[model samples]
Target: MKREILTLAFARAVSVEFIATLIFVFIGLGSALKWPSALPSILQISLAFGLAIGTMVQAFGHISGAHINPAVTIAFFVGNQISFLRTLFYVVAQLVGAIAGAGILYGVTPANTRGNLAINALNNNTSPGQALVVEMILTFQLAICIFASTDNRRSGGVGSPALSIGLSVALGHLIGIYFTGCSMNPARSFGPAVVMRRFSPAHWV
Candidate 1:
């Protein structure tokens, strides 16, 4: 791909990223708080997240490749699927999209239900190293799935890319939720952190 500062493709990609992320956060966070009672089952929460991602990707995939996660974007860049300049633009767009998503979630939700906007972190006894390892493992699988599902050469096209992507997200949440609330997407964590004013070094990790 040719390197350009800002092109129509980049803009569309960024806009799609922002809107998709906003929907992801709004639905995911909304479920975490509003439906906490009914959504006590981890499976329920996982499905909620998964379904949100699936829906967003279906809605926005054609517009921006449906990259709602920064980690996936980084890995794709590392995998040489995207150009450097494009990577920079995508990352910035993802971050801004994340913040916008979080902001909208904060505004729409009730004050009592905010709960720090569901910031992700280690549980009571998990170590920092363990958390990192877990995040890496989960994110690796996630990024790999993104690469595979989006790869025209590899995919059979039996399932929608949106469905596959959402399934991957839910898979991570199933295992990582107990570890670090399963923040496979840094933008997902960062957006809420910035909004709740609880941005921490750990979040950067």
Candidate 2:
């Protein structure tokens, strides 16, 4: 009976991660699609990602912790919060979900407007080293925010972890977008790159 319960919980967690990641990538990338009539500003794009993530966290936090990003999953694992098997499952689910989200966006969007599904890339004049540093810093900030806001011991002091996390994401993108297209999440960068078949060597960094 204990084993069965654990299995059920695992399944629920995986399913929630997959679905939440899919929704996050879909809405976040969709916001960056380039329409001829109106292009989204940096602020708009940031808010879109922030709100999408916040909404998912609120919807799924109780069930699976809403770990829609592999980086977040790995962080939790490193902190000894999740088992190795669970971490592996979450990472695989996140990657698959990201690909599915990007694929769906490709299918539904007009070819001219898709814009490589918003794959992360370094802007001109930015060196690969610079981009890497920027990505690391951005992701670190986000990860720290997530840990602080979601920690149950500190949860009482925070009004909404979801909102705080979302704001952190938005803050990262608001600045990082200018340099590395703001890919704090590897799954977010990987999904669109896989769908578009556009891989930059720097992406692995």
Candidate 3:
């Protein structure tokens, strides 16, 4: 009976993660799609991702801790917040969810407007090394924010955890977008690349 209960809990957690990640990728990338008359501004795109993540967290945090990103799941594992098997399940769910979300976006939008489902790439002449540094820094900041906001022992002084995390994501995108299209989550980058079949060596970085 105990084993059955644990299995059910694990299944529920995986399902929640998958659903949250699907929502995150779908809404976030959909906001960046090039419409006929208007292109999304950096602010708009940033908010899309930020808000999506924040909303997903709020919606599913109780169920699965809303770990929609593979990086976040790995961080939780490294911090001993989750077991290795659970971490693996969460990461797999997130990746699958991301791909499903991107795939749905691809199916709905016109072919011409579906620009690789907003795959992350270095803008301008930014070198691979520079892009890597920027991504690392942005992800590190995000990870720290996650740890702080979600720490139940920490005293709260401001808004909800969702809002704080959302704002951080937006801020990161505002800065990192110009350099590397702001991909702090590997799953976010992987989904579109897989759906569009547009893998570049830089994407692996």
Best by lDDT: 2
Per-residue lDDT of candidate 2, residues 1-108 (tens digit): 235337877899899999999989999999999999899899999999999999999999998999899999999999999888888889999999999999999999
* Model 1 accuracy (lDDT, Cα): 0.80
RMSD, every candidate, angstroms: 2.2, 1.9, 1.9
Tens-digit lDDT track of model 1 for 1-205? 5545447777778777877887887777666764444535678778888999889889888877787887777787888877877777777887887888889889987786778778887887988888999999988888878777778876355566788888988999999989888888888888888888896656755
Instruction: Rank the models by TM-score, top first.
Output: 2, 3, 1
For each candidate, what is the lDDT? 0.80, 0.91, 0.90
* Candidate 1: worst-modelled 10 consecutive residues by lDDT: 31-40
| Residue runs of model 1 more than 4 Å from their true location after superposition | 1-6, 34-40, 155-158
Decreasing lDDT order of the candidates: 2, 3, 1
The candidate 3 region of ten consecutive residues with least summed lDDT is: 1-10
TM-scores across all candidates?
0.90, 0.96, 0.95
Model 3 lDDT tens row, 1-205: 2353378777998999999998899999999898878999999999999999999989888889998999989999999998888888889999999999999999999988997789998887898899999999999999999999888787656458899899889999999989988999999998999998998879866
Give the Cα error of residue 13 in candidate 3, in Å.
Answer: 0.8
Candidate with more favorable, higher TM-score: 1 or 3 = 3
Model 3: CA > 4 A from native: 1-6, 156-158
Q: For model 1, what is the error of residue 24's alpha carbon versus the real structure, in angstroms, after optimal superposition?
A: 1.2
Q: Is candidate 1 or candidate 2 better by lDDT?
A: 2
